[model samples]
Target chain A: MYVILVYDIGQKRVGKMLKLCRRYLHWVQNSVFEGEITEVKLKELVYEAKRIMDEDQDSLILFKNRDAKWMDKQIIGQERSPTDQFL
Target chain B: MYVILVYDIGQKRVGKMLKLCRRYLHWVQNSVFEGEITEVKLKELVYEAKRIMDEDQDSLILFKNRDAKWMDKQIIGQERSPTDQFL
Candidate 1:
């Protein structure tokens, strides 16, 4: 499944959430992550998220798509160029 | 339909995109907006978005859900309490 995760958390907790997400997905933008993962991973991610969350001061939204093709994604600006070291 | 709009653009253009989205949806978090909008209004929003976008330096993504109930939203932390100026 393709999952889009967006989070609104306290400023102090930002780093922790970002690190947790980066462990499982690519960092697309500020507090927003999208990528493919299995149902099991999704559950694991959610579990970890719940553990870290304040439960009373944060919001986390996940939009799941059965397939990436079903979603139309548009990029308008210049993205960071891939590192030439890999090339 | 419930629409989720997310964007990544130049720092200089952030204000314009934020303003444009604020006109149609609630500002839920940084670079994220969500609300219910009609198909016609969606088109209008897209058209206006195209006009403001740099096309080569920004990215705008819209996720459309047929219904809000289909999506699971979780809030983990404290949200702003509604103010009652009258009360």
Candidate 2:
């Protein structure tokens, strides 16, 4: 199972999400705001991400198959972000 | 450059995006809510998508890259959506 989390949010806390993903597994990700994580690894990623995330609004975790050719982009922010190169 | 459009929307318009892409290029896609389109092809996708969108709210186009391993998921909607398979 693959996961694509569109956690509808602003720009301030992108770092928080990325760090959380890093804490768990090796992922090919994009967008600190909107994450393209797989479901097999999602439970761990979300658990960690939720730990750092403040209780403000609701976020959605969209799940898909890994076989699916799913991709995400960074539209609103600057280029060459620190979050670009994933571990 | 790669593009990931988080149009911050509900569930009614996912189909609108996939149809527009099929009109343009042969892409490997995921959610219609958040699109995983390449920057080279972004201009065509965004232009056509913007035409169908109502413009009621502010949407963002977050551009990252193709080299970047960005992915997206389908969190809120149901399973086996028509928007899953891209042409």
Candidate 3:
């Protein structure tokens, strides 16, 4: 099964996640990874990436279950953290 | 165009979003609201809901563009604020 790691990144650290993960694993063009990804491994990736996120900013990482019928299109939105207040 | 507000709620504040918006507008059962929701009005709904989120927690709100081909099925996942990582 393909594991899609969909991220709502903090914008500033977009490529940092890629740099850290790409050397050790193969990443799909759309930011997904297929094959076995243990919970332990995912934690490591997030932990390392955490350094890139500012306390004022954070990132969202969703490990999508590709085996399931998921929406294939890229969803879009932008509400600068503070800006999201208005919804 | 239908403005789809997809929220990654801060666990404690789900109903707050619905309660505030449902009164003035009609909401679809699957967490999507369709109507001419002006940005000005949406801000009011979000602003009111934020009072319920904890200082340690925040919410992610995406105003899904419904005209686009979006996956209509319910997407599921549970991640505590500091837990997601290894993938």
lDDT of 2 by residue, B1-87 (tens): 433344433356656655665565333323323334555567666666667655564243443334324433433322322444221
- Compute DockQ for each candidate against the true complex: 0.38, 0.19, 0.06
Q: Which is better, 2 or 3, measured by lDDT? A: 2
The residue-by-residue lDDT of candidate 1 on A1-87, one tens digit each, is 777788888888888899999888766666788788788998898899888888787877777766655555544454332211110
TM-score of each: 0.71, 0.36, 0.33
lDDT of 3 by residue, B19-87 (tens): 765653445333333344555775675566566555344433433232323322222222213322122
What lDDT does the true structure give each of the candidates? 0.71, 0.44, 0.42
Ranking by TM-score: 1, 2, 3
Model 2 chain B is weakest, by summed lDDT over 10 consecutive residues, at: B78-87
Q: Candidate 3 docking: what grade?
A: incorrect
lDDT of 2 at B2: 35
Cα miss at B58, model 1 (Å)?
Answer: 3.9
DockQ of 3: 0.06
The TM-score each candidate achieves on chain A is: 0.87, 0.44, 0.49
Candidate rank order under lDDT: 1, 2, 3
lDDT (C-alpha) at residue A76 in model 2: 31
